[model samples]
Target: MEKKSIQNTLLMGFIEDIKLRYKTGNIVEKFIFINIGVFIASLLFKVIFGLYKTNGDFIFNWFALEHNFSTLITKPWSIISYGFLHAGFIHILFNMIALYYIGNLFIQYFTQKQLVQFYVLGTFFGGLLFMLSNSYFPLFEGTRPHLVGASAGISAIFIGLTTYMPNYQLQIRFIGFVKLWHLAAIWIGLDVIGLVGSNAGGHFSHLGGALFGFLYVNQAANTKLNIWDKLSGIFTSRKKPLHTVYKSSKKTAPKSKNTDLTQQQIDGILDKISKSGYDSLTKSEKEFLFKQGKK
Candidate 1:
């Protein structure tokens, strides 16, 4: 009975820790957790069904996007689901690394909500554009291609950052600092070339995302393109999670100016962690978070 009781206590503590992490984590961490969680679950399912020896394509089909019009009709969720699906470890690693750097740099100028909106929209449009092209193009007339991975979303983020700050220089390995627009050009060019070799749908989706990223940043600057705010407002009226985010700050005790933690500051740190990971935290920042936990 004591051992069982101890097990229960430990499990409860672990669950609370997980909840706290998710509650405090910024948009990037949440997305990574969801994607990695889904990937792990997919592998577990395959192993359980003894399909590990096979290609395991069937295991991921339920979530992977289908280029075929008829097959996609019943699995519409794949539009977004496919972004979270990855065929191999290397695929996910590169995509996540790109998202981390791009998203972090993006949040330096834009809000976290804007970053998420770009990612979501980029992935959706990428898939949509691919489907539209495939439906009309003669080159892919007889093939049914499956779209998967976060590359489109990552591509959108990468291009969006480049579009927003075209002259920003990045220090490339074995090369001196170069302008973002130059990098964007090279990346898109490679994808265009890859389309002719193989994985045409993936490459097409990437171009779609890149195009959207370029247009979205340019268009918003010219007008009141507050799409993320409008979508958030829709959820704000619901009897759900939105209300919790803005709950009374009165609950927390007041502090001196030296220790004061504003919402914006907290959000910035969270965003940094999301883009750069926990180890990026300084000693003082870690101490502040520890203090918050105690509270």
Candidate 2:
């Protein structure tokens, strides 16, 4: 009975923890959780199937993006599914790190829906490029393996931000300060050179994602409208903020129902956050910012 009670308590605590993160955490956190969750699920399936003496390659076959167009007809979901699938630790580690840094930067200037669109569409285009190239390109006529990993999605994000803010600079260890455009150039250059290497499909997919990023930035600049927003309402569920009503005293009614900070004040705080990042905020400021978000 005691063990059962302890287990129940732990489960409840875990549930609450997830709820809290969902309430307060940003899109980047959610994306990371999803990717990690999928990776862990894959590991568990591998272990379980191993114990049962069954092959677990079915999971990869179903989820990971394949090169052949004929195979994709049966598993169309692989276009986006492959973005969340990673074959190994190093593959996921580098991808997740790039996603974290680039995603955080992306949120400063764009909405969550835009970020989701970039990731989803990036993977789709990457998969499409891989399939077309494998089918048509004389270079990869004989060999075309399955594609898996978050590299294409991560590439889209990093290149998107770099294109949007080309002049931006970041301080790197042993490298001093480097411009965003320079970093992007290096990344694309490496991928271009890597096309002749073992993972040519992967490199091509990365280029496909980078192409989307560059084009997105150019189109957004010219149109002053987010291409992703056109289809956002169709795919995304919107959560409206709740309004709290309060009773006024008989003696004097409040000038404004909201006792919270003004729009100007909030804008100032946001600017500060954008310029210095969230770590620069004081304890009280952080609390206020959090409360404002909840409101």
Candidate 3:
């Protein structure tokens, strides 16, 4: 009875620990868990189908992105669904590794919500590009390749971070320190070269994802967006700022104190950035800055 009780306690503890970790984990960790869970579920389904002497790939076929337009129309969710699936152990392993590092770095400078936007949108664009390649390119005439993997999403996070901080240095193993843009260049360069290779569709998807990341970060940082301003100015040519000449000292007194406090906090954060660097700021500090920037 004692031995059985001990075993049961240990098993419950292990299960509880996993549950706790998942609950406390950030969005990146949650994504990793989801991917691993999907991979294992796929394996289990494959084994079960094999035991019955039947094809197991039908399950994957339903979820994986089909290159054919007619087939894709039937399973539209596969564009995002395929990002959570993987072809093999090595595929998921590398993708999860890249996501973990790049995603963690990404959250430091951007919000978790923005990360999700980049990842999902990247996957969407990548899948579209993959389908387009199959339809237009003669090389894929005889092939019916299905897209599955988190590489497109990971590529977006990687390239997005690189774009946001091109000069950020990372100490690589045996490669010393390398600039973020340098690594991004190599990443895109390989994909570009792979266009003629067997995995040309995969490369196309990667480039599509990288392109989104680059364009998004560039547009965000483009302060002198004169064309956009000009277009908006044309539309709002007659609009003028509303002014309030009336004063309410009682209402304004408390607001001024709050505004001063917020400004002091912002000043403190700016000073910290100057002393250490943007990366040195804590998560809360970074979030505060991010919120302020939106305003």
Candidate that scores best on TM-score: 3
Off by over 4 Å in 2: 1-8, 221-224, 228-295
lDDT by residue (10-125, candidate 3, tens digit) is: 99999899888889999999999999989999999999999999988765988999898898879989999999999999989999999999998777655676678778878988
- Cα RMSD (angstroms) for every candidate in the order listed: 10.3, 9.2, 8.1
Identify the runs in model 1 with alpha carbons over 4 angstroms from their true place.
Answer: 1-19, 51-59, 221-225, 228-295
Q: Please give the distance, in angstroms, between residue 45's alpha carbon in candidate 2 and its true position after superposition.
A: 1.2
Residue pairs with colliding backbones in model 3 are: none
| Model 3, position 81: C-alpha lDDT score | 93
lDDT by residue (12-130, candidate 2, tens digit) is 99989987886788888888888888998998889898899998766787899888988888999998899898998898888888888888877766677678878887887788888
Give the better candidate number (1 or 2) by TM-score.
2
Looking at model 2, report the run of 10 residues with the lowest lDDT sum: 240-249
For candidate 1, write residues 50-140 as lDDT tens digits.
6546655554878898886677789988888899988888888888787777777776555677777778878887998789878987889
TM-score of each: 0.69, 0.74, 0.76
136 Cα displacement, candidate 2 (Å): 2.7
Which residue pairs collide, candidate 2? none
Global lDDT of model 3: 0.78
* Candidate 3 global TM-score: 0.76
